[model samples]
Target: MPTVSMLDHLVLTVADLQATIRFYEDILGMRAVSFEPADGSTRWALSFGAQKINLHPADGPFDPKAALPAPGSADLCFLSDRDLDEWRQHLQAHEIRIEEGPVRRTGATGPILSLYLRDPDGNLIEVSNALHS
Candidate 1:
């Protein structure tokens, strides 16, 4: 049997693509980039670390997409090199509200300290840093 390794990217269907880009860039420090598909249309994506998030308009004609794509429906977690305190301050400085945390939780590797917030689309977002043993 074969195993899947890691995520390369995911598509997010968005109500407002620019707003989604702004939230990810201003708050999370990700980069927004444009790509020209084989169809010759320019498409947008957000890139960070080893992953990318491709953005699709909520109103369709976009193909080979999620069966039921909708905004405000994703719950995403991102790893941080910065500590929770720094994330707390950064989010505060951006005037983004924390829904919960600095709460301890299980991470893929070990224990993690997480801070929860919502993006412009109301998708739940968790920013977390691993706690060493």
Candidate 2:
């Protein structure tokens, strides 16, 4: 059986496109991009490193979409370049509430230190860094 090698991107159905963009871009530091898809609808995405999260409108007519895409449904973990302490401070500076954690969790490769917060649409977002042995 042939399996996919790695993640390139994922789609997020958002309640408010601008709010989602603001939370990811302003608070999380992901870059927001708007593109014309040739169908006249301006599409949006949040990009960081080599990965991106494409934003789909809550009431989308987008082609080849998920069966039941909804806002506040995803629980995502993001690898932060900043240390956990720094990420905590940055989130505090933005006045975003820390719902849970600074807890140690298993990452894809090894241990990670993570902090949790909620996006505007209530998606559970985790920002973490590798815990060095």
- RMSD per candidate (Å) reads 1.1, 1.3
> Could you give candidate 1's per-residue lDDT for residues 9-89 as a string of tens digits?
988889999999999999999999999989898999999987999999897627988778899989998999998899899
With a 3 Å backbone cut-off (N, CA, C), the pairs that clash in candidate 1 are none
For all predicted structures, in order, the TM-scores are: 0.94, 0.93
Candidate lDDT values, in order: 0.92, 0.89
Error of 1 at 121 (Å): 0.6
In model 2, pairs of residues that clash are: none
> Candidate 2, TM-score vs. the true structure?
0.93
lDDT (10s digit) by residue, model 2, range 1-133:
9999999989999989988998998898999988888789889989899999999989773888888888998999998778788887888999999988899999999999889999998999999888889
Q: Please give the range of 10 consecutive residues that has the lowest summed lDDT in model 2.
A: 59-68
